[model samples]
Target: MQYKSQAVAKPYFIAAIGLFVGQILFGLILGAQYVLGDFLFPAIPFNVARMVHTNLLIVWLLFGFMGGAYFMIPEEAETELFSPKLALLMFWIFLVAGAATIVGYLAVPYATLAELTGNDLLETMGREFLEQPLPTKIGIVVVALVFLFNITMTVLKGKKTAIATVLLIGLWGLAVFFLFSFYNPVNVVLDKFFWWWTVHLWVEGVWELILGSFLAFVLIKTTGVDREVIEKWLYVIVTLTLITGLIGMGHHYFWIGTPEYWQWWGSIFSALEPIPFFAMTVFAFNMVNRRRREHPNRAAVLWALGVGVMAFLGAGVWGFLHTLAPVNYYTHGSQITAAHGHMSFYGAYAMLVMMMISYAMPILNGKAANSNKSQVVEMWAFWLMTIAMVFITLFLTAAGILQVWLQRVSDSPLPFMVVQEKIAIFYWAREISGVFFLIGLILYITSFFIGGDKKETA
Candidate 1:
């Protein structure tokens, strides 16, 4: 709200929350399907619902990153956005395209969607997370370019802070890495190898840069920490992130028909991958402990702290659990991967985005911070969602261990479907936990509309 143009971020943030709601609903559907296979068998199959769930997650987080940049950059630069109109235009364009593409996935069969969207020419449809049709993929590149242009030009015309510079580099890397998704060679090995260049590199690589930058920006505002100190921590975090994560890509190569060397290389590097998250946890708590003054936004401060703890436990701890080659050989593609995917993404990216919303939404909505009641509710939502995710990961991890034991490790190995039958109890438990997650999401969306007394920070 420092500049009128900053208001543009409002819609982007709102859209992100809306999509997050959609993502959770589909997630519940997926969970139910895990236990009750025929719940929506043909009408909305597991794969369809899953695509909707995951694609929404990616799209919404992208919205969060973009909105965060739009809001923070102008303030850091000490000027308005360079092209507010372009930013707005890109918002609607990206939103509409994303919505249409998701609807296309759910409305029609995926193969039909691909055929209609001209994936026959590019053949980028069958990949794991890059399942967006060719047209959608092209649109993604276009939108990213425009977004980079607007933010880059604004930063150039205004101030150039370390945080802003690092953010731009991360965004640029995101766009560049995504290009690898288009390189769908015939060899399945090559396909998966390069695909991780986008998937792993984004989450584990450049996205960490964005995460650190945002964390620094929020800590500076809330903790009254010296800018120099926070930015220095930011740089250190990103450096460790790349040093560990870039090489951590080898872990994926272990099972992908790659050389045996990856097993050693991946195990060694990925084991150290949690260092940055641990550092992040320390950095966050240290900043709060040394705060010069308390900001009025106690809920925002709470979120900042929660991001540190949860990101470490979910991404760092859980990741290290199965990251070793020996354990992963049995656990790969099991419920363990699913567990890691759920918590790690939620802990690192999803919660980070929500933290930004919790911090910025009140200011954007014309209050220094939310009413104590509203903040209290928001905090409740945070705990509910976060705790629910933890149980879900726990349940999935249980299912995965049982599965690996029964099907892979045990002498009397059972068939995959037979093992699944044994694990039905865990699936049921996961479905039950997912219900709470959905409820938490509902509360999260509802907290925004509540009104109460606005109090200033210390």
Candidate 2:
């Protein structure tokens, strides 16, 4: 709303929320498939549903990040976007390509889709998160480059702030690290090694920078905190994140045929990964407590605090539970890992994006904040989703603990399938949580249409 060009973010946010709905729907499907393996066996097997579920997560978050950047950059830079038209064009291109990729996943077998999309030339298709075919991968790179170019130019041409600078570093790092996905090695160990460069580094590393910057921006606006004070917190966070995140890559090296020394190094560094998140929690609360003015977007402020606490618990505390070399050795790929992944992602990235949306959407629509009724509804969505995710994580953690006990630690180990049957109850609990999450999402979208008497600003 500060600059005309910021309007471009509207479509991006809309698309992100739309795809988010799709992601949750697919997630419910995957959850059902967990209990009933043949729920959609031939038509939409577990693997495909999972692929769609995760791919939708990555894509929608990207959309949210891009939209947040487009909205924030102009105000931070004190100027208009460098090229709104180009930004809009890239948005459409990215959206179409993403949609087509999902359609491909649903329309044909994985092998056929890979072949049809030139996966033979560069075989990045079979990787866990980088399952996009060559064309889609290429499209992502192009869109990212153009998107970065637009924002970077705008920053260079205008004023630079700590938030914007850190955001640029995070964005640039995101693109740089993604290149590792293309470097698939023939050796399984080496492949896993480089794959973590993309996977682990992303969620734990640069993405945190992005998270920090976005949180700082919201805190500054909502709390009326001094930029200098927030920037100090940002500096400490960036330092801790880099120090802990970079060497923390060793954590994944423990069983991957790496040096024996990594056992000590990975444990030490990865254990410290929680420090930055802890600091982020303190920073969010401290700012709100010291607020200069009460912003009308109380819901946005709630989200800001939620991201802090949830990110700390999900990414920090739960992560620390199994992050050490000793614990991970026993629970390497158990449901515990899945628990960490689900909570950490939702807390850190998903909620951060929603926070940005909650704050910016009202301003974008020419108001300072939505009516109190609308905000109350939004807050309900927040609690429902956050609480539901917590239950999901807890149930998975329980399942993982029981699994590790019965399968790995026991004298007579049970088969994987047998163990899965035992854990069916936990999966059932998680599916019920998923239904609540979907309802929360529905309420979130519904909030937009609910209007009332409110102050209007231009």
Candidate 3:
């Protein structure tokens, strides 16, 4: 089937490149802040930089989702997007709004932004409810609703709702739920409650749908696997993720001064969270192994494989490591949490988005497939980033454990400041390792524009 507009995927590709560049810059700033506390502050404070980094990561991944949807929806539904122009308009509006929010973050102080927006970064590193000032908060809501409306209307009018479309709708729900955090009454307890609604629900809940669907799409395309079989696996993985994840929000409540009953609820459900990621690992490899024909995009397949394995390790194994209330009690707000967040989001979400974009680039540009050399470069970048992230996670995990042992567990624990001094080496190690991750990103970004030799189809 012909797409109504030939340029269906271009906007998403551009957004992906911009977001990737943002991710790298943010990484460098955050790494510098770790090693050198007084690095680019006042002009670009660490807190503001972090906000941009984290928020942009989310935004770009969403952009990647939108791109993937635009690229794949036509093929899946056997028709074009209901309105390509509307999709383009939604892209610009969201982009402009996202940029504005970043500017607001830099301009407003922690206290002022918090007071204005209701999101108190000073108190909790910006995990408070969506309470940004009225204008900024409203902007976020409007952008989200507009995006949801566009995607939903497209699906409804096209009369096409496959696994990919289902995932897109799930993403729309995630966007809407995030808006709820903006105005959920002014109680700390309730604020923390709904904050998880946005954070936990998105990552663990709806976004997993996006991840599963994208991975399934790539695997089926590259491996010549039967669509029905691959899609069924997609359904199973997302179903399991939501089943456990909704309850897993209790995990955060363990320390947030909520009911004590959450310890049981959170521990049990979160402990079970790894089951679906394990299923995903099995799903990807099994589909590849069972393929009816070999495809040219071996690198995309490799990335699909990497997503499965990494998701299992990052979201499953590492998550299980701290699922217990007894363990989390000591490691609650430490670097251990950072370890989990980095790997899980990067592995399960970020890399999957990258894989989707990588797959689409060749198709959109009319290349038969990605060049072998570019694929090799991407593979190297994957390893570089993966290994570096592993080192960072290990360093922080060890340091967090040590901190807990010395500061919380010992009979005569070391002073907090003294313990921090002891762990400074790990912080340095983390920063040094981050340099490799940055190098990987550099190579990955270079490859997109300066791609290697193209294959000529017979």
lDDT of 1: 0.90
Clashes of each: 1, 0, 7
**Superposing all C-alpha atoms, what RMSD in Å does each candidate have to the true structure?**
2.3, 1.8, 3.6
The C-alpha stretches of model 3 lying farther than 4 A from their native spots are: 1-6, 111-136, 159-161, 451-458
TM-score per prediction, in order, is: 0.98, 0.98, 0.91
Q: Candidate 1, 387: how far from true, in Å?
A: 0.7
Which pairs clash (backbone N, Cα, C closer than 3 Å) in model 1? Answer: 296-457
Per-residue error for 65 in candidate 3, Å, reads 1.6
Q: Distance from true position, residue 35, model 3, in Å?
A: 3.1
Superposed Cα deviation of residue 242, candidate 1 (Å):
0.6
Pairs in clash, predicted candidate 3: 116-132, 116-133, 117-131, 117-132, 117-133, 118-131, 119-131
* Whole-structure CA lDDT of model 2: 0.94
For model 3, residues 28-135, the per-residue Cα lDDT tens digits are 788778767789877888767877778778778877877777777766665566778877887788778777776777787766766765544333234532424455
Kindly give the stretch of ten consecutive residues in candidate 2 with the minimal lDDT sum: 449-458
RMSD of 2: 1.8
Stretches of model 2 off by over 4 angstroms after superposition: 452-458
Instruction: Please give, for residues 89-156, the per-residue lDDT of candidate 2 as tens digits.
Output: 99999999999999999999999998898888888879998999999999999999999999999999
User: Of models 2 and 3, which has the larger lDDT?
Assistant: 2
